[model samples]
Every structure is written in structure tokens, then in C-alpha cells.
Target: MSLLTDLKHDEQFNASEKAVAQYIITNKEEVLNLSIQALSELTYTSPSTVVRLCRKIGLKGFKDFKIKWSAELQKEYNAISNVDPDFPFTDDDSYGEIQKKILELFTDSLNQTSQLLSPDKLERAVELLLQADKIGVFAYGDTYLPALNFQNKLMKIDRSVHMAALPGENRHLATNFRQGDCAIVISYSGESKNNYYITQLLKQNGATIIVITGNPSSHIASLGDLILPVAESESQSVKLSTFSSQTAIDYVLNTLYGCLFVSNYDKNQSKRIASETLFLDERF
Candidate 1:
């Protein structure tokens, strides 16, 4: 929990400490620019009392409190509302405004993706991956970014995942994969002809297919054994870039990677470091 949260509910604080806490919480904007002595003066408390309150929240002194508190304030400030992911900023927007809008879009996309996530589907997907004889990921273009990322992390934990980023190369994986194997198809639109051909081959070979796409009703999504929704608050083509879809895809894949790691936490955690040391020389 944050220091502010502790101040509001930590019952051990006495009247003087509570008064200092109240002043800090109420005058957050002022506190951002306040010194330790100035804060004590405003709360009508001694400097020693302010230091005590800081220690109560696990901080060493007033400087530590101010730096952490400033970060919390900045996080709250970035959480804006009603920001359309498509065309989030105008042509005339300044560089700082563009940066803020992009951050807002990412925050909004992560929330939306979490809302659409299904616990049952997630459990089932993880179970299939755990039992699969082999695993392959099919993605091209922008979606290939997350496919490559997932493959990298999974490899560190000793889960070998095949991902072919080049066009004709993925066809080989789809065609050669076996009946008990698993295939993850990442296509934001769920209507890519490129993905559709490979999807057919995977189905023909009796591989279990997991689809991550924006449109649940689209052709590719309809073919999957399990479908996970993609958060697509932005337009498919008329937008500045593939911001929302990419963010949501990365979020979903990362969540899957986390769950996979936790399934065998102790071994996986140690194995990751061992893998890095064995395969990488400069990691330290």
C-alpha cells in the first residue's frame, strides 16, 4: 500500500501524527513543494513529529516521503478520461501533449483488456499449453512483435515456442505441427487472409488453436478452440498508429507468461536465472 493509504487507516497513529497526516493528504499540491520544516509549521506540529509520521509509513525522512509522493501524484494526473485511442492527439498538439495522450491511451487500453479477460478461458488456455506436445505462434506484421516477446520469455523458463515472422516461413510451422500440438494465432483484425490460410492448415493437422483478435465474430475467431478478446479502442486503418491493439496484445501475452511462470514458481524462477547464465554471458 501507498504511504497515503497507510496514513488514512493505520490505527497506531496518535492525535498529533494523525493531524500531520491529514495536512499532508489534504494539501497534496502544496506538500509537493513543501520542505520538512514548512510542513511541520503548516500542521502546527514539531519537526520531530513530522519525522515520526514519515517513519510510521516506513520512510527514513521527509525527503523520501516527498519523492515517493510526487510519483504517486504524477500517476494520478496521467489517468485521464474520454481519450479516444484513434486520433488521440491533433496535428497541432505539442510534443508534451502527444506524450501525455499516448500514455493515457495505453492506460485505458490495459484497463479495457483486463475487463474483457475471462478467468475460465485463461485457465483453460494455460492448461492446454501445459499439456501440449509442441507450441507454435503464428503472427505477421505488427502482431509479430508480441509473438516474438512471448517466445523469448517462455524460452527463458524452458518453454520452447516456435514463431515464424516471415510470410512463407509460418506456413511450414502450421503445416508440419502435429495433432496434439498448440498454435497461438495473433491477428488483431481476425480477418487476415494470411492468418486464415495458416489457421486452416493448423485445423487440418488437428492442432488446438487459440485466437486473440478484436472481432469475436470474425472468421479466424470462429475457428479457434478458445477465443480471447483483444482491446481495440482505436480504428483499424484510419488512426495515427497501431497503439491500442498493440498495447492490448502485449498485455494479454504478458499476463499469460506471468501465469505460466507461477504455475511452477520455485523451479521456473530459478530456472530462468540459470537459463540466462548458461545462454547469455554479459547479463551480469
Candidate 2:
């Protein structure tokens, strides 16, 4: 039996579900990355109680809960932070004030994205990316900036990645892709026709699709093999560029890169050595 399943029948721990849930919601940030003993201590419960709590909630174990809890807490924080200020806390015309406001919006967006993530979704996306033969990335308008940055990061890790940065070239470039590949589409609203088309084409070619979008139920969601929800602009009064969406994309890209590094550390060593040698002339 799973460790959590074994602990479910314990009477002493049966009534603590509400308390455990509250503890998780309150101390999510601190204990989100914590071990079982650390979480138990933080929650003012015994390790066995923590284990039992996992069973109650239907998680495999404490580690599984950590991923889901951390994501939910981050999402909650993001949704709160992105909403526009009610009044002029700082004047919008002031450069310093504008900078601070932008920071708040992006930070909130990143937080919300994390909270909405499920452990199963994150794990499944990671598995797809790691196993894919090739990866294609695309974004339109503002989303393209982060897509370009993501492509660069993956290239540094020696991943075979392609991106569409030129006009009228996205479709032609995308058409060359085949099965066993992956397509990562980034859109703030997940409403872009171009992105939706790309996703549909990729799927038709037997490629797995990963969509990062602010709208979970948008048309592109249907095309996605995995849906990653970023934060959309929360201000109804002002037209703000999609800063938070890009920030969330940054976090996901970094997390995926770290996972890939760990999975291919030995192979990467040879690649890194060859890269350093090839660039030796530029170094001098």
C-alpha cells in the first residue's frame, strides 16, 4: 500500500482535516517546499498526522502535496497582486510610480500562475518536453519577446529548438515540423487566431502541444496537450501591456530548463566542453 493509504484508518488523525487545510493555506509559502517533518513542525502537528492528512486529501505522499500546494498559493498571491489600485497610490505619470506599478502587476501575475498549477500537470509537461525529439516555439505580438528568450535559454542547454521571429514566416517554418515534436505556444488571452492555428497544425502532425495562456477556457486551450495559465491584465480602466504573462512564462521556462539539466547532466557536460572550446577564440 502507498504510505498515505496505510495511514488513513488512524482514528487520532481523522478529525484534523480542517485544521490541516487551514495550516496548508496559511503557511503555504514557507512549507510548500518543506519536507514531511518540516511541514509537520510548521503546521504544529506530528509527522504521522501530516502523513494521514495526505491520505485524507488523496495525495500520494507529502512531496506530491508540496507541488500542488505551492502552485495554489502562488496563484492566489498573483490574482491578488494584479488587480489595479483603487486610487492614485502613486500618480501614473510619474516614472518611478509607473515602474513600481509595473513591478506589482508582473509579480502578482507570476504568483497566480504558480498557485493555479497542479502537480500532475507540471509533471506531465516536463515528461513531454524531455522526451520530445524536437521543440518548436511561437508567440505573437508581446508574447514573442519571451518566446525568443525561451528559445535562447534552451539553446544554451543544447536543446533543438526553433522560433518564428520574422514576418510571414511562422506558418512556413511551422509546416516543416513532424510527429514526436513539441510546440510551445504563448498567448496572454489564448485567443490569437495565429497561435490557435499553429497549435492545431502541430497536433495534426502528431506533435504534442504545450500552451501558456492567461485564459484557461479559451479556444487555444482545446488545442493544448497541457495548459499553463498565466495572469491577464486585471485593470479595466487602463490599457496595460501584458507584463505578468511574460513573467509567468519566464518562471516556467526556467523550471523546465532546470529539470532538463538534471535529467541530462552527463550528456550536457560533453556539450558544454565542446561549446567552451568552440568559443575559445572569442574569449581572448
Q: Who wins the TM-score comparison? A: 1
Task: Quote each prediction's TM-score.
Answer: 0.70, 0.62
Poorest 10 consecutive residues by lDDT, candidate 2:
85-94
Tell me the tens digit of each residue's lDDT in model 2 across 122-175.
778879988888888877776777778777877876787888758767787678
Model 1 ranges off by over 4 Å: 1-80, 276-284
**Total backbone collisions for each predicted model:** 0, 8
Q: Which tens-of-lDDT digit does each residue in 183-272 have in candidate 1?
A: 999989999998998999999889999999988888999889999897867666787778889999999999999989998999999997
Error of 2 at 36 (Å): 58
- C-alpha RMSD for every candidate: 11.6, 17.0
As a whole number from 0 to 100, the lDDT of residue 275 in candidate 2 is 82
lDDT of 1 at 153: 93
lDDT of each: 0.86, 0.69
Count clashing residue pairs in model 2: 8
